[model samples]
Target: MKKIISIYILLSFSFAYPVTLNELIDLAEKNSPVLKEKALDIKIKEVKKKQIHKKKFGEIHLFGSFNRFEDPRILYPITPPIDPRNLVGAKNQFITGISYSVPIFTGFEIEKNTEISILAKRVKEIEYLLTKNQLIYNIKSIYLKILSLQKQKKALISYKQSLIELYKNIQESVKVGKKPEVDLLKVDYQIESVEAEIEKVKNSIYALKSALKTIIGKKDINLSVIEDVRLTELDNFNRTQLLKNINSLDTLKQATLSEEISEKKVKIAQGKYLPKIYFTASAQRNMGNSEYKDLWQVGFIVEYTFFDFGRRKHEYIQSKLELKKAKLQKKTLRLKIIQKIDEALSEIKTAISKIKASEKQLLFAKEVEKIEKAKYEEGVSDLYDYLLAKSQRFLAESSYYQAIYEKESAISYLQYILEEFKNE
Candidate 1:
């Protein structure tokens, strides 16, 4: 019976429990409408690539036409019949046919188009990954912020409890004519102030959680986020290796794909200077009042536009300019990515220093508060000193939690910049 009850309790906890950062990110990816849209874009690009590929094989069409003439004419070309009655002529005729046209050559236009489509698909895939990475980063940052707030709230509650005890002690001292009634009132005011701050923190937490729900596409606003201390531990990345691996980032990959696509466009434009060749074949039956004739033909066609008022030349130049622009953009993006990496690393270090400083400050504040508490109770100090010490302690505790979470947030951002969340 005890085992069954334990299983039931575990099941209940599994159904509704604090989700870890990774679990939240997974939920956001699975439910986020933005991610869904990006996923659909990938599929659309895939279909587009296939469409461009099929174009190389050409198209087949079924065509029908009707015509009326003022004078009777032969429905189709035929040998003259010996009997005049056997001649097939009509004022109205109908022809129905199926025709196939395939591009034999367009100076590599088809090949270039196929290549562009492939590059486009790759770009879409990278874009999807970029979107997912961004979502994960957002979830991590918000989760850290929420955890920080909760810790601050807990510290505030502790502060309030201490104040309440001090208030009761001062009340008794005032009754015994050892302390002023104003001391009790002062502690009362401080308690009220701390309570207000706690309420503010509560509201802020609610707002952050609401935002989290929106991002994760969840209807439940009562979300409990778990803090994994391991996430705060930084990995020592080789700065040189990180710099060298920047090219593998999704942003750079996207830019590179764009440049390649532009190059393909330039090639396609250059192809326009050459003649286009096609293979055509058709089979048809012409129907008249008295006869029906079947006809079929196969042929190759070559079309050359030697002069188009320099249109092809202008297009080729334009494509070349675009390719140059793409190259410039890629260079700019590379520099920016490097700058961002530097900034994130610097932030991580700064947060680490702050965490250390705040940790020491909190320890000092706790000792000062304890000393002041004893002094105030023994009449060695006044209420003001005790209140100040408690306030300082609360601030130090809040700062410590803030610094810790800030480091976590910075690390999450660095991981995002590095595309570390792509696989997840």
Candidate 2:
């Protein structure tokens, strides 16, 4: 009954759903606080764009006013019975009106302002994409590290098992007086070392999982059964094609859009020096008796700021300076992206070479281990030689797996730079 219960528990663990890289990224998209904040920023920019567009339609307002005055006396001595208030205006009065105004021309101010709003919205969109890509990169980094630790743990566990079996063989040899008891003690020490390494790796795995949970905003998720990291082949990468795709990067796009926005700001500042034309119309009714009971009027007005003590001039200069700065920044960003691509390509190449070398070394070490094991079993070799060979094989295996994961991580970084996460 106990054996059956243990088997059931093992099966249950095996059946637990494993978290995939895509799933983690999806969760981050939905739950990450940083992404959420960026989303709100995009919304704010969108609203601002709508406001700028709506301003082109003009405005209408309804207004009313009332006034009361005290009794008045005659102004002239000959008109002693005449009241000055009656000659001048009503003592109590009320007025109401509806007024409308629309801009007939704005020295391209409205057009430039709208362009600024549109560009601002695009900038926010790029910012959101940048944040999203960064989050994906972070998650991929953590996931790859976890896989590396897991691989190391597996290697250590395998090494520990081998040491155990070797220890058993050494103990038998000691009983036959063929090997010294100290050899058994050495094997015991090696086993303990491997076990210690295993423990350390397990702790690292726990810490990494906690970090991943924090990123995805899930505090209690179990991330033990993550998918294995797949290797990216060098033959599949094309540097020329990748460089062409660099324009799709969020960072580059953002810099370009920012430069455009700065240019629009310069135009907006220049608009202040030109004339503004507007069409105005109004209808009003006097509640109290007056010379005109109701009136309506319409007119057009053109106004220009002939001078503002160099205020507008200074603003225009400042805007041009900002535009220059933005252009420089955009140029710098392009160079940085090119550098990043080159670096990632180099890393991928280096990791691939290391992986190949480690694989060859592992194969050679495995052969050496086999020979050492046979020699030790036949009393032709010391425990030290056999243990050394086994350790070399273990290290080679670990190094190979580490290289594989490193290559995967480098590819993930390259994808991030290329904005492949956006497609995902």
Top model number, TM-score: 1
lDDT score at residue 14, model 1, on the 0-100 scale: 72
Error of model 1, residue 219, in angstroms: 2.1
Instruction: Provide the TM-score for each candidate, comma-separated.
Output: 0.90, 0.84
lDDT of 1: 0.88
- Candidate 2 lDDT, tens digit per residue, 236-296? 5898998898787778878888888898888889888889999999988765444435667
lDDT of 1 by residue, 145-180 (tens): 899999999999999998898888778888989999
Report clash pairs, candidate 1: none
Measured with C-alpha atoms, the lDDT of residue 96 in candidate 2 is 86
Model 1: per-residue Cα lDDT at residue 145: 87
RMSD of 2: 4.5
